[model samples]
Target chain A: MIYLDHNATTPVSPQVLQAMMPFFQERFGNASSFCRIGRIARTALEEARASVAACIHASPDEIVFTGSGTEADNLALRGVCRAFHGRKRHVVTSAIEHHAVLKTCEDLEEQGIAVTRLPVDCRGMVDPDQVKNSLTPHTVLISIMAANNETGVIQPIASISRIARSRGILFHTDAVQAFGKIPVSVDDLGIDLMTLSAHKIYGPKGIGALYVRKGSAMAPILTGGSHERGKRAGTENIAAIAGFAQAAELAEKHLAEEAVRLAALRDAFEKEVVQRIARARVNGRDAPRVPNTSSLSFASVDGESVLLHLDLKGICASTGSACATGSPEPSHVMRAMGLSPMDAQSTIRFSLGRDTSQGDLDFTVGVLADAISKLRHISSTA
Target chain B: MAKERGDRDDTGMSSAENEKAQPIQGPVLFYNDTVIDHFTNPRNVGEMEPGEANGYALVGDPACGDQMKLWIRVDSGRITDIRFKSFGCPGAIATSSMATCMARGKTLEEAAELTDDDVVRALGGIPEDKKHCSLLGIMALQKAIDDYLLGRMCAEEGDDLS
Candidate 1:
């Protein structure tokens, strides 16, 4: 019942739900159609675009809506890569990027484009110096995330973006986790291309947007009918798009206060965890991070087991490793930070949301203490 | 949904000692009722005192991230008592618990022959991904039996099982 996995996805807020309801019913006309109802749909779509663009300080015309954040990342990476296909193309990115960007980079490697994966430090930060050193004349794009989904560690995006800008390379950031937790201005951060997802920001799934700076040259990855200014092709999910814009507006309106409140709650939870449980440590504790996330590692215990025990107590959390689900791979972000396999698997992520409270954190820490000790006891003879 | 959120927020009871576990009213996700039952209230969750347990086995490695310590008190060539300590997820714990329950009184030969399939089947069925976890219990039990057989030979030569 205590939902602390906001980094995974957030429930659609009531206001966002309300905003989406009308589009799903009587007003379900295609935005591309030329009829009267279609004109209404087009107007609503443009308004939503403007709302999202305003939240991130980009022009509405620069935004192109996509199916999801993953698609947007693909659009940014592959669009540019495909445009410069058959050239001496290369990309620079960090090891701690989300799978959306990482896997896309991997796929690019298969297609003969070179990818330089920079490693993060123990604090889960990608150094700007490393980004600068990795760049070459062949490096056409540099993609780094604004914040990590697991550790919530904020990357030195502005510094890295500055490097890319000075070198005349396209810079892209997956801001799916960072959009609401931190201020994400495309111009201010010097991002030429960016990916944004709705589900992580308390909006409906299957709707996202990409910000392409004016004059940023890239080919359309999705080809067909002319939509999203011919950059992406598909009939838009009007309801989800409307919900996304409303969610972005909501996040902009309350960004400062909610960021402060969630950070307080997250820190209190972390402090209580370390005090009550032996060997309980926070991952990326020294890094500048987003406000709502806490990644904790309990030594000598497996994270999947702890997650199971917490689930029994009606507390929702996530583990870094997918071992329990038949995937033995621990988080690449954790591994890239030089944690032992066991340490990586022992990590858990707790992401706070609007509904989280001091009391909720108190109860969660209490449950966590129980789960940790029980698991440790199960492993150790006493 | 509202009621569940309210229950989580009823966290005003700040004292952990006073926090009574509200019985789970909803179906546990992924796992069936049987797996949930054994994991929630796992049986035989302890170690045998030294000199009392003749057979012991530890399966899985910490690097692999899941392990169990199982002990058996064999008598007259029949398993008289069994206990286990496990550091694993629900599937590992549940299947191990069920294995111990199934092996408590079985003869040494019968216990050693118990398969991972039997433990999994005993739990109704685990998820396809977690089906591999059942091997931890069955492997540990067979290893304990092997340890017992090895100890009897070494006991006549004056040695102890670690």
Candidate 2:
């Protein structure tokens, strides 16, 4: 089947799978043990840490592996907020953030921390100046995503990070969708903390990392053995980490070339779909989005029906977040972009990945146009 | 167990085409085979001319984004011809198709007595979330019968069903 939902998760690369196989079997010793086998595991773990750190231009000591990107996001927000719970209790974030960050901020508010959710433009981009103005003396952290998973609209992270730095506030970016698909440098962006997931970058699932720059103070959310330098607790998933390192290395090496290639494919698909389908338009058309995402809104057609039709044709796509599917709520991101409820429900997000090809794009556009017409035909008659 | 990362919990704000989901594999098992069959090949899917039908009704909930229109020809107080147009999910299409099929030759009173359960039973069973879809079809059919009776009682009932 043609898989165009890479933003949800990517298939693990063969290279990553090969790199991780040994850790799950022969090299099964815990990294913290004193035996020689344990030392081998420890060395491998540290090497993986360095590889992940290098992907984002960070130091090895700065990377803290976690169970998932959501956990990494939780650590960044909760950890930072807990550190300043008694002093500063204000946080700044964009309205279009993944639920990981948006919901975490809501939890923080329950603890008496005020949250300023900055709005995005119709193109789904957060203005850097708004980040600057939202800052207060009590603002301890400003968290924004590097790029939206749905719209793929790239945000001005460097500028936003600069604003947070000038005010002595911490900056965190959920770069799960951006890290592998685009170039992300913590040093260049002045990002104090960031979240990355391996599964999104063609690595093993269940392994993600939170990058905490040196000297950034934050408490740990998980309490257990003094693993991850006491910042996070739990025995590391060595196999997943090994695979994550391999994926990160490959992503960093081919980021520029793959981005250009995928952007071409995505743009071609968008152009054709819009041309062939009546009243169908691209979301975030003018924004500087990541190379792999195309969100389209077909007027007067229910996105769920279109998605079901696509699924029936051996195509997989989503109207909202994968988790939010089967739920009746409209996409919050589309609503935040000022789309009407009908328009929000009418959206479909197609994300390309390294595996996507021109043939796949052609097939998608052909099937998509057919589905839209079918749905619109039923709608107009009804 | 390996922590599955790629199965990202895209809670909100992100969207993907979900082919991996079991339900999308084939008519989501929440709907039975009959519902699937009818939804896949919905019957009587076109609108009838307003002048051709003796009674017509349109019912919709703007909040639910579901709407149904039913047209019925009352000859000798029996629904001789029936057609429906629906805009919603698979269940919406299936229920309306089933409703029209069930109402085709029934007397006006018999059609009016049809409930959401009758539609569900005819389609085997609908998913719980789709129970309302069956209700929509039944409500539209009942309203059409009511419209037919009201038009006969009025001296100046026009051809406009709206």
What's the TM-score of each model vs. the native? 0.90, 0.89
lDDT of 1 by residue, A1-382 (tens): 9999998889999999999999988899999999988988898999999999999999999999999999999999999988776574899988888888889999999999899999999999999998999988899899999999899999888999899999999999999999988999998899999999999889999999999999998899988989999999999888989999999999989999999999988888888899999888898999999999999988777787788888888998898622223465677888898897777878899999989989889999999898887777766422
Model 1 CAPRI rating: acceptable
lDDT per residue (tens digit) for residues A51-140 in model 2: 999888899999999999999999999999998755998999999999999999899899898999999999999999998888889999
Most accurate candidate by TM-score: 1
lDDT of 2: 0.85
lDDT of 2 at B38: 72
- How high a TM-score does candidate 2 get? 0.89
Minimal lDDT window, size 10, model 1 chain B = B8-17
lDDT score for residue B91 of model 2: 79
